[model samples]
Target: MTATAPDQDIALAGILRAQHGVISWRQARRRLTGSAVNHRVVSGRWQRVHLGVYLAYPGQVTRIQRWWIASLAVGNGRPALLAGLTALRLHGLRLPEAAEPVHLLLPAHRTDRDPPPGVVVHRTRRLSRADARLDMSPPCTTAARSMVDAAQWAFDDTTAVSIVAATFQQRLVVLDQVRTVLGTSRRLRRRPVIESAVADAGGGSESAYEIEFLRLCRLAGLPRPSRQSVRRDRSGRRRYRDVYFDPWRVQVEIDGSQHMETRGWYADMRSGNEIAISGVRLLRFPGWAVRHRPGEVIADVRAALEAAGWHGPSLSAGSGSATASHDGRVPHRTRPILPG
Candidate 1:
């Protein structure tokens, strides 16, 4: 049942339009001769972007087009899904840095010895249909799997934490989805790191600000505060505190741009007044302060904790201390809280 020339032309046009003006040599050959493909490239109507991928139109390529080209080139005749940081970016997660060498996941039975430039091929035996959806135009992993994979492939622990935090903050993926993907993944590298980061994100520190604040508290030697602690105002209305040092009666609030709203601002003011009347000292830090001026914020928090009668060991300026690392990494320690 071969289609007529008019039908083939219509199908090819549809594919070109849907794939952002990109097509593979093998696909083009299905509708066109080898000479026709070469003639289009030679005439500047198509540009060879990868070994077997060509742009149908000679115009600026978009990020998605680049991803599509990479996938098609590596795919060859097997399954190759965009993954890791690349997939996360596709799902709209703001990464600290752009992911170079686009990550592509291929099945174990398949291999790409000559991946196109700026593409990194990852071989996995467990790339099941459940883990990826081919219906997507660019064809990538599920949001959950992409987030977890990005976290595992992060450059450092901090970056990994940030990736998970951003994914949750953006609401691109849910915690349960991440957990399910991890449970199903067979060879997930750095499983514990990914789990810890995702746990922290789900445990109320979902934003970059909250994650940075958590790290700051750890590095500053402050007692771990209850995250998103529940409380009731005088009218019996429920409210949640970002971080609460129960023993010291200190409340730390991380304010993002959303708090700039008139209603939100008023609510915060009311909450602060109530908290102050209840003898709870509130320390508020803008998201920028938490991320950019952490040292100053930590110092202020330390002073507030001390003023609130916290008499635990103070942060010392030496090796293994918060000040020494300066990277916001707190050394693990076990110290019982003593009576002030």
Candidate 2:
């Protein structure tokens, strides 16, 4: 019935600006002309996230949600892109899991500034241009920067693999981009372990699984395999391999149910059969073998190598079924697959 107060509009806009959506009654009244404690108390619309922060949900807070929060938190707009686990997640990289203390970036001068609760701000005088590549998203880092950062900054193998896996999962990133970013990353010198990890990077079977497999091979100390290889036999027939060991004339296939496609299954078989005639030994392993049962898989590989005249040490055994000397999750259904 009353003409409503003016401060109420200003208060609402301020609340929206912060992205917290929820505002304290006292603060609302102080900032907004028409805002009143009684108004919010009477209205059932506000949802509380903390003592002061409110969120509108059933509607979720995405990166946009965080950006809105960041923008309002520091309206001046300094040089910060969400860094650490936050950036890694935004880039869709697979990490061991995730860490707390949402990371942030602020300029060098602000490095020592006290930040709002629940955010960790990293200070950098200069951020890599690559970090600004994907404007279409947010103030997030480029895919390659994200991957490089993950490889260098991740807590462990699981974390690094997850980040790289996530990077590839979001097909927006190309291999060339990853190579370009890594080629000049300053963090490169700080992370030698990461170099070995990236050396084996490959594409195919788009998921965290393959990334973990790459990490596993690195852990097992196996030679890095060539990705998406193409070779021809005497008849000029082309063959494709997920991974190729050119030195050993061997091809390792990491198969998941996805690869066993109705059409792909037959096509792969036809191509594989042809490659067999060219004197290349074909070795296929299931996704599970690389994951839960890597030891057995590793041993089987060593044995296969020995059989192929690889003068390496005897292999260790755990989940291998190829030799019938060990128990396996999926009994080794693969054949010796001798070369032609």
Candidate 3:
């Protein structure tokens, strides 16, 4: 049956909308002729985003648009999955910092070719259909695969572990899934570090903040504190603290921006009041302290623990520690915080 031009336009619009305003030349050719495609490009109605991909709109290109173009540029015979930090970001996993290079994973059979500008193509022989998600817009790698890939591609161990921790804390992907993906990836760098970070997440460390706090404790020679410890308030309501030194009757609360929200703030206040009434010394540290200023965080925590009847050995906050350096740059330890 012959279709009217208007019907074809509508069909094209649907395709464009489905692919986030980007389409492949082959897909466009199914409904548009070479001359018609060239005419649209010349008229500025469509812009060539990649060698064989076009932007259906003239407006500013978007992240999703670039992703679609990268995926489609691989051609039909092979699949190119948006991968690494890019895929993890799309899956709602926030990174410690901005990532770049618009990573794409192409099947090994696709060959190692130069990717379009601003795009980095990775050829992987291990990528299977199960590892890729075809349902997502711009079809990217699955969350587990993307996370593993992101961690492997990360420049540092902290960034890599943070990716694992953030994804697990957000419940975007489970530990078993990450393990499965890691198991399949035999030669991933920093494998032990990734495994340890995943184990920390499994142990109830909700975020990278909690993991850093634990590391600080270990490096400072402080007694290991129970994590996500449950304590009952005066009203019998149970509350969980991020880390608790039961012997010293001390509880450490790791506060992030989420705690600043009205509801979170009030809830924290209530928890703090209850813990205070229960005669427990509470120490609160901003999440940033644990991440960026670990040396200071350890010093403060050490003082707080000592003040809370912890007669343990004095901690040596020296340089080359696992947590952080105690160089002159770090602020000196302040007086121990008293019970509130």
Candidate 4:
């Protein structure tokens, strides 16, 4: 049957709209003649992004478009879901802006001899229907699975730990979901580190700095402090202390880069004054000190605890609390600061 020019244009627009302005060569061939497709490319109406993928529009490619391009370029009639850090970003995890390649996951048996530029291909035998969010546009691994894969695929142990912690801290996925994913994948790389990060995250260490502080406390054999514990100020407003030694009436606040700003500095000073007036000792450490000058941080924290009458490491400090679970399991103290 012969179709009118308007009909063809309408069909092409529909395909582009559904796929974020990306069309595979096969898709284009179905609706366009060979010459027609070539002419569009020659005229700059369509741009070739990958081997057989085309960007139907002319401007710079958006993130969503990049997802579609990666999916179509390597999918080839099989699953090519976004995984790892790429999927985590789509699920609302805040990450630094960098030229990171799109990470795509395919079945273990599928192989692409020539992967597209700016795209990283990963093949896995463990993928299942349950691991994918099929309803999402340019289908991706579920948040939990994506986080697990991200941690496994990270460049180093530190980066891997940060990925897991940030995922939980940002509330991209709940602890249960991550645990479930981890249970299903037994052979994942960096499993131990990932589990440790999860435990810390569940214990209310909401940032990398807080996680490091917890490790330092353990290294120095200090009593574990309850994290993100709630307390009322003079005005009766509830505040979440970063780390609190409840038995000794001491608090430790880890200040990230944000605390260096004018507003943050003023707010922190006000909070410190309030803590002092309440007769509880307060210790503050910049984020860099926790990472770089661990010895100094440990000394100051120990001094504060000793002055507050902490005789030695005592289980009573946080024995049954979120911070100190005897079985190495974290209590349900983590609450999402941001909506997932």
Best by lDDT: 4
- Structure candidate 3, residue pairs in collision: none
Misplaced by over 4 Å in model 2 are 1-63, 74-80, 88-101, 111-118, 128-130, 174-176, 179-190, 202-224, 230-240, 246-249, 255-280, 286-296, 309-340
Overall lDDT per candidate, in order of appearance: 0.79, 0.55, 0.77, 0.82
Ranking by lDDT: 4, 1, 3, 2
> How would you encode candidate 4's per-residue C-alpha lDDT over 192-281 as one tens digit per residue?
667767777867888878887786676466898999999899889999999999999999999989999999999999999999999989
lDDT of 1 by residue, 1-340 (tens): 9889999899899888878788888888899889988999999988998788899886888888888888888988233699988887877777656447799988888868568778888777777778896877688998898888777787876677778888887888877788789778777776755676676677667576786677667656778888888899999988888888999999999998889999999988988999999999999989877766777788788889999998756455553447523664344343322111
List residue ranges in candidate 1 displaced over 4 A.
Answer: 77-79, 96-99, 212-240, 245-249, 254-279, 284-329, 333-340
Question: Order the candidates by TM-score, highest first — what do you get?
Answer: 4, 3, 1, 2
The collision pairs in model 4 are: none
Per-candidate TM-scores read 0.75, 0.55, 0.76, 0.85
Instruction: Please give the TM-score that candidate 4 achieves against the real structure.
Output: 0.85
Q: Candidate 2, 110: how far from true, in Å?
A: 1.5
Model 3, 136: alpha-carbon shift in Å?
A: 0.7
- Residue 54, candidate 2: how far off, in angstroms? 7.8
By summed lDDT, the worst window of 10 consecutive residues in model 3 runs over 331-340
**How do the residues 28-105 of candidate 2 rate in per-residue lDDT, one tens digit apiece?**
545544444445444745544333334444356655565534423432323246665566666654445533655666
List clashing residue pairs in candidate 1: none
Tell how far residue 206 is off in model 2, in angstroms: 6.2
By TM-score, the better pick of 1 and 3 is 3
Ten-residue stretch with the least lDDT total in model 2: 331-340
